[model samples]
Target: MLAIDGSFLDFKQLDLLALRQTPVHRLDPRAKVLTTLCFIICVVSFDRYQISAMLPFLIYPAVLMAVGDLPFGYIMRKIVIVIPFALMIGLFNPIFDRQVLMQIGSLDIWGGWISCISILIRAILTASAAIILVAITGFPAICEALEKLKMPQTFAVQLLFLYRYIFVLTDEGVRTARARQLRTFGKRGLGIRHFGSLVGHLLLRTWERAERIHMAMLARGFAGEIHSTRRQSHFGRTELLFMGGWISLFILLRLYNAPQLLGGLFTGTMP
Candidate 1:
């Protein structure tokens, strides 16, 4: 029960963070969304063996987190949770491709190893950017931004509903688990046989609760779109600068390997 509650709180921390009054949080959501999309594209566009080139993209998320007043440790923890999935994606790289790509001192690194490490770096960069985006902009605003950017209304509404009901589903599951625990002490109701029944009950309860909520919303005159109490923001000059600056930086990083150029300059290796 405690674990369920703790996980729920942790999951909702991004929404809590989004309520802050920082400059990053105040930018038009469209700007942040587009900038983040550009960042992800640049980071993932690198060749499979390119690692150092992608390191420069980390600055984007770092700046956002600092300016947005987001908790670094909390965001890092969230990113760590997704790292295992990234690892799984790249796990077989080294086994399939064994050609040597680089040599450092006595050790030779294979192309597959480099590609695998590149995937890990890409995962960290992209994941951090995404989490920071949600922490500052919130999911609702993001969905709204998508709608404004010409996404289908149905698709955006579906995304918004999916995000909103995740909490509802989680709450239902937590309550069901607690009730089961109270009814059966220790390992009595914890068997695999009881698991299916618990899930069935939770699903039925959630379905009923959803129906009631839907009826209430309909009665309240909820249209196809959900509206926010917050004042609507426009795409102003500040948003333009914010989006343009980051996109320009991303383009620069994509075209030139900043780290390699700096190393060359320091070592007098530039022609």
Candidate 2:
């Protein structure tokens, strides 16, 4: 019960972080969204064996978190939770690709190992960028930005609804689980046999609750469009500079391995 409730709180905390009055938070959402999109594209564009070249991308998220005043530990924990999926996706690379890619002294490093590490690094960088985007911009503003960026209204509305109702669904699940625990004694009805019934109850309860919410929204003049109380800011010079500068840097990093070049220069091996 506590785990479920805690997870819900953690999920909602991003909105709370977005409420802070930081420079990053004050920028137009479209600028941040575009910059983050470019960052993800650059991070994923690296070759499978390319690792060091991607390390510099970490600077984007780190700088954003600092300027946005987001809590590093909280964001790191959220990133860590989804890492296992990336790990599982690349776990078998070593078994199938045994060809050696590099030699370090006596030990041989295989292509699979390098690719696996590359996948993990890409996952971390992309996940951190996305989490920081939400922590600073909030989901509503992101959806609004997407709508302005030519994303279909229906798609944007559905996406926003999905994000919003996730909390409701999680809350419903928690209540159902608690009710099950209370009615049973000493794990009598807590077995896997009752799992299906508990899920069924949760679904019914959630459906009814969703109907109520929809009715309330309709009564309050919700006409398939989300409105915000915050004043909408124009995409001004600051936004242009913010997006342009980061995009230029992303292109530079994508084209050249700065780390490798610096290492060569330092070792008098520049060619």
Candidate 3:
């Protein structure tokens, strides 16, 4: 018999917050994780002018945030922050299209505007789902879910370490900022002398701390792997039901046109 080699795979990182736990947190990270993937796939599959058909899709995020008991205002705030990026990219569509797709009273709307709306909606749906997924499930759980779904362990470990140290480094940054403030009583904050020393010192301190942390981990028996044998999240009937309901809704929206009152009227189709 020929022997198979397992040495070709490379190491990968884990996302720390993906492994967190809450009400929405504990319900099968795999399901929550996969649902987000499905959401993206569905949103991106829509035609550029597929606006009204996509409105029903909002129910997915709404139900998720509500049932998952996520922070409503916080999720909305995150959406706001990311919207500008989509708008900046999508705004150009109107200037090019100028083709009047529809007429409403005195104003005529171009297909470009409609397409822009579709792109923006797709962006919001994709970004919001991602944010909510992270907000509810956290990063570590996501990595764990990925691993459980057959992702490489090395990558998962990297994601874990990256997230673990990001906060640590951020705290270090705060301290460094405080020290800089103490020295900048009269000088401009970003003057040449102050800026050079600040950059130099922060880099030195970060490297020193990283080395120390690595040593500490090695001392505590952190071998080549960042191993944790925690129980993986289980998928039960509830999770199956949750995933199925949304999936069915997605398929239904994909196959037939959405109802008029649900925003389909805006697109002039209600099949």
TM-score of each: 0.88, 0.90, 0.76
Winning candidate number (TM-score): 2
- What is the alpha-carbon lDDT for the whole of candidate 2? 0.90
Off by over 4 Å in 2: 181-193, 221-230
Please list the Cα RMSD from the true structure of every candidate, rounded to 1 decimal place: 2.6, 2.3, 10.3
Model 2 lDDT per residue over 11-90, tens place: 98889999999999999999999999999999998899999999988889999999998898999999997799999988
TM-score, ranked from best to worst: 2, 1, 3
- The 0-to-1 C-alpha lDDT of every candidate, in the order given, reads 0.90, 0.90, 0.75
Q: In model 2, what lDDT does residue 214 have?
A: 89
lDDT of 1 by residue, 1-271 (tens): 8966786779888899999999999999999999999999999899899999999888998899899988889999889888999999999999998999889998989898989999999999999999999999999999889988999878987898789888888887888888888888766775888989988887888789878988998999988667656458789999999999999999999999999999999998973
> What is the Cα-based TM-score of model 3?
0.76
Return whichever of 1 and 3 wins on lDDT: 1
Candidate 1, which segments miss by more than 4 Å at Cα? 1-4, 177-200, 223-230
Candidate achieving higher TM-score, 1 or 3: 1
